[model samples]
Target: MSGERAQPVREQGTEQDADVDADAASTEPEADTDAEPAPVTNGAQSVVRALENAGVEYLFGVQGGAIMPVYDALFDSEMTHVTMAHEQGAAHAADAYGIVTGKPGVCLATSGPGATNLVTGIADADMDSDPLLALAGQVPTDFVGSDAFQETDTTGVTRPVTKQNYFAGDADSVGDLVGEAFALAERGRQGPTLVDLPKDVTQGETDHEPGPARTPDTYRPAERADESAVREAAEAFAASERPVILAGGGVIKAEASEELRRFAIEHEIPVVTTMPGIGAFPEDHDLSMEWAGMHGTGYANLALTMTDCMLAVGTRFDDRLTGGVETFAPDAEIIHVDIDAAEISKNVQADYGLVGDAKAVLDQLYEAVAPTPDADEWRAQCREWKEQYPMTYEAPDDEPLKPQFVVEAVDEATPDDTIVTTGVGQHQMWACQYWEFTEPRTWVSSHGLGAMGYGLPSAIGAKVAAPDREVVCFDGDGSFLMTCQELTVAVREELDITVFVLNNEFIGMVRQWQDGFYEGRHMASEYGWMPQFDTLAEAFGAQGFRIDDYDEVADTVEEALAYDGPSVVDVHVDPAENVYPMVPSGGDNGLFALSEDQL
Candidate 1:
């Protein structure tokens, strides 16, 4: 059975396969023409068919023994399978693909180490609420609890990080399980879902064909908020003097950026975004305060701190955004809107909680409000704050290059619509602060999980998802070293991704924290020795350029961006520099530190 080719069922006719079968039959002795043909479907074929039914076009995975059957089945399928350097890279690539395409990205891996390697990416997706689906090849069911070679409880290990997970019980039901997993990953408050495919099950034979992807009948998310709550919230907005709209990642995930922009502009309200919601509102807009939180714009923080009425859409009000909950919007009556009701008031208390789709709720508010708030004075104050605490940094010609300068140069070099991915660290903060993201889905990063090695692999995924668009990654020296090996994958695939390594010779963010909070005692944070990333990129068959001074930045950037395939620019930056506008953990957002002295 393993040697036999899968006779996959497709929505489109398989005339060519039938013709091939007829040609083979004409050359052989045929018998039993009157007898009905036997079913030839296997669990691996069913799994692939289920993805086909869901219209999945790309899959990221590493081939391994337990998963060989599925990979073999994929041989005849039309979907493009990307073989990544590691299971972790596969997961991150799939995650980025999902973010860029607004669909559930698929990743696959084998048992034990392979499954464990995908944990970080899975957790990252779960934290950021990105739609992703992971299929892990498992050991045979008979060896489930006997400590079999290369075996682990894959479902149990991933359960906490997934929206839902299933262990394929048998061949006949495995296909439907994959469909259900795909639907659950993409539906309602999107997050990662998983299905554990045992080797025996995938190798087992079955004739069942999974139908179109559909959520379980019991799964239904609210599409509209309660009318009474929206009316009262609208009334609260109308009566308030200082009104602000806080847009979070959910706004982008729900495709409600336009709706959010309309509501903020129509009501003449100030707009402040969460870091994850950077592109929800255009930064150049008069009402835009950029984003608010730790390392957020001082003006955005000041606005949120002083508002009388706050309408927060699609945000969980996480600790990074709120700082100290008691001090966060103390004088404001909060109207919290979210797709998941559980997220409402989970971190911060809400005076009015609206549970529904972000776009639907924004539309409801857009229609329900009778009179817009008179916020001329409030808007003036916001402008004044922006002027007072501008996002500024100095790059002296004699000194080492600044990370902010590098980020700005990249921003200038690339188009506004270019997608930017980042590995977690100080470099990520610099990218967030400097890059003017005018479009939704342009920014991708590891937010909640703060995984360091995400940038390069995500760049690969982003490039694959939008081949026509420029995909650039801003990665820290420490972060880049974690997954630099993925450069091989990018070079092999010929992906056009430009990576700028902010080489500061230290774990910049950790060193900053230690400087401020731990009496400047830098322990293991600083890297005493590091490789020349430009040379390393060349070793991996990529275009590599080194930037030691501001003089070389512009030309080097141009050369790197001009390369037809993967490129890396190693920008040596000030080791002493640190990210500022920092609110100490559990501190007030309004009193952000502009320097280490302030901290």
Candidate 2:
């Protein structure tokens, strides 16, 4: 049921007496059990009841004194609440939930430290255009500038990162503010929104009626590509012997997979996706190529170099995507299409810029261009590139386990439609490399911010959003430990999600740098003390599996996937195994890691 349509029906007779008694007891002194019902319920209770009416099944947050009233109200309500180890975990979970479900995910936090902690997650959602609503409890309105305990200017702090923000001075506005927040967060160019509700306001009461349901203003996303522009693009595409489509996260946001596929197939153009765009095009499709730019496939980079025309859609050409802009695709005439005007020529200058929705733009392009005869020469060239530099991982015969083996096994065991979320580091890259993403929005990760410890919480949110679908987190041991405390949340909520931790006993990325740049002077990256993941999982009341042998990786993953509830699989991988094809920091993309002999 839609949130707007799920308003609760008030029950009639004797229940009102019980509610009245409970309300009376909630406000009266300890000795007075017969005090008249409190003058009115506080804004906190109003907000909680509003959420209940809106059919919110769960909320993620960490408790703080400033927000105690809201927590108290939540305890008395039916909505499930998941407490996180950190505010960032709550924010990331909310972002992931919104991305997976196309609804506004909510995160709650208190003043000062709690509000500041959510900054990274907010910026991440902003950069990636995910829908999220963050409710931050603020200090009382009277203490606005007093530097009072737990007080912070949350509205100011989140202004730049959020699409919209509200600071509630009137308690009666809480419900309407939340409704507006949800609408703004999910509107065009979707992004996070913040609502700062002061503690005093939360505890205050007013006689005003609850505000009417909010209806979001219709947003006509710019316009489709013009006839002339479509004709020009089609002419350029048809004439170029080597052309490619660079798809970005916008493709998934706009749900343009069908149009993208049709356009690519009709023109015999190969498609490459950005990190967030991994699942925008099916990885198994014949025309799909691995990602481009830093850490991209060798063949994809070479193809970018050789291509005569590049059509980029719904993407910002980030430094990672363009390598060094001065030398990237010098021979290619770039045609950029995006809904955001600021991104059109922000980095790499485009030969042509079309501002519009991805699906709408592609629809126009499809209409303008007539289906062409098969490009046998282009297909042959692409086939050669694919065969020569295909992404592959050969497990070492003597190694305990390879992360790629675990990733591949999980991919094979899970259905094609399953959603996969990842934490940053080797495991994230391995999931990108080994997992076959066939549907849009199926692969969720901290692509822009590259935040660690996002996997488990994000998986929790995804499962909540799509309860019928299988959700899994591909995490690293270091990242897992950072946010593993949230496991209790999964157990408490009984969320059906799987967490696969690649336990290598080291920060593999940092170790790789130490080996490459510091000549193997392994500093503080190694962990001499190890936590038993199986025990940790059991403590949280979830099934756990540990695999140390390469041969047992597949069976263990299968077992974890079959578990009815939340489960964790800790697969021990070779500590020395490093993610290769790396573009060294402060260097051009061409200066990638190579063998000592090559160097």
Candidate 3:
């Protein structure tokens, strides 16, 4: 089904400061107990109450000994705790929850292994800029350095991945720390933040306060572009004959897709999305060129190179987007509009840098610049490129099934409001290409870090956070094996979702790269000993279907989607297939290998 674009939940009291603090956050600890807590008291109780105050609706993670007190506190709380099969899954679920709901996702875990298990997901969140708040149970404060049972330096391990972290020293500090953790996770460039609550803190008793609503004093992103810069950008846009808009995740984060669409239409400019910015503009729009970069659409890469003015908004020109600084969009004088000042000239230097919130920047630019038509020739060229290098995949008559066709069929059958999520690799790229997302926050995947097991858990979070919407998770066979057990939670919770496994009996993307880049040395790539995926589904108490031909795709997908509960459709696909139109590492973006045989 079609879904509406998501809107961000803005925290009140955010003001622009001329001298912004560079640090995202600092240690927030308090010991005041002068105020009295209501009829109840305890550090754990304070923590739960604090979460409630921050408007947290769901918590995901596994429980353990050191965290029992917090669990006891949650016993009577309104927030729902989803016990994932593993802590890593919990972290991903929370990350996905935040992505869909525009709120900081919360995950709870015990110390030691539980805390460590969240590292991968934490890193994933860090790389993708997903908002998450992780709460961990620690050993007693006395045994912090002593390495007591189930003890771990949660703050230390997570510090590198988080915006900031806190150590709860007493009952009075638990509530304050929770508020700070939420603020930190949502402020600036969002990512994971943590609060390591020692067992003593949970057991300790004292009066607590949730503190005032946090307004970031030091870490405020620019809300609007400087007047001079906006004027220059408008002049640049007016002068350039061939211009393209490079939209990225920042557009999604800023909730500026509408503004982006309006700006693009007004200028009659073609738009290309960065990987994470897939849905920033409707793919079906005449001005839309799906995506550009390493494995992006061939026409998109060509347009980027050929454009005279490349207006990159809310995107860091990372290595993936810019194959090389000198060769990237060689003809374009790039004008970058971003919230972060450092990203201005970090990689591909911009002729003009306008630092501001995407929505505000686009709004002001819209007013400063009027619709101009100087690109009839450029539009003709882009349309020709799209026609000549159209996105296509072959389905050999003798092959079991083609993965791309499976995705296409599913896309056609799913509702207009369906939320499609994916694991990293061939499937992710296919989803990016095949699914026409007209709305933001509907497409979720692990883009930057390419975490394999991210799909299932994130799908769970999407389903949980937006129960009225339909969620479909596209997972690879290998990636599915990494964390398929989480499907059990779907069954237990009776969550309505469908998982499609592209069973190719190999690490499809890795094999594809090895074939092209490493002279066909396929080592440790194929899944020679395949598991019975259908049986695995049965083990999780979900219906499973296996298909060996393309004809079965339609019927099976329909059947699965129609099923009352969660189901897995395992369709055997061609093992030797590869994603096409890939630009080799360090290769010029203009010179892409259009398909597997092209390179």
**Regions of candidate 3 where Cα sits further than 4 Å from its true position:** 1-40, 212-216, 371-373
For candidate 1, write residues 1-599 as lDDT tens digits.
11133221112238998898789999998776687423338999999999988999989888888888899888877688878889999999999999999999999999999899999999999999999999999999999999998898898999999999999999998998999999999989999999999999999999998888999999999999999999999999998999999999999999999999898888889999998898999988988999989999999999999999999998988899999998999999999999999998899889999999999999999999878888889999999999999999988888788889988988999998999999999999999999998999999999888999999999988988998899999999999999999998788778889999999899999999998989989999989778999999999999999999888889999999999889999889999888879999989999999998897
Candidate 2: misplaced stretches above 4 Å? 1-42, 45-57, 69-80, 172-174, 207-223, 371-375, 586-599
Q: Residue-wise lDDT of candidate 3 within 374-409, one digit each (tens)?
A: 889999999999999998877878876888898888
For 1-599, candidate 2 gives per-residue lDDT tens digits of 11222221122248889999899998976865575423337788767766655556767788887887788767666566767668988999989988887777888999999999988889889888998889898988998999999888899989998988999877887867777777667756779988898988888876443443353556455757666877887777666777888999888888888899988877778888888888888888888886876677766676676778888999998877777788777888888989877888899888888788889999987776654524667667877978876777667777568888888888888899899998988888888888888898799898877888889989988887788899989999999988898787777667778998999888877787787789889899899667889778998899898999977877788888888788998788888777766665534554554432222
Top candidate on lDDT is 1
lDDT of 3: 0.84
Candidate 2: the clashing residue pairs are none
State residue 424's C-alpha deviation in candidate 2, in Å. Answer: 0.6
Please rank every candidate by lDDT, starting with the best.
1, 3, 2
For candidate 1, the 10 contiguous residues with the lowest summed lDDT are 1-10
Give lDDT for model 1: 0.91
Global lDDT of each candidate: 0.91, 0.80, 0.84
Clash pairs, candidate 1, are none
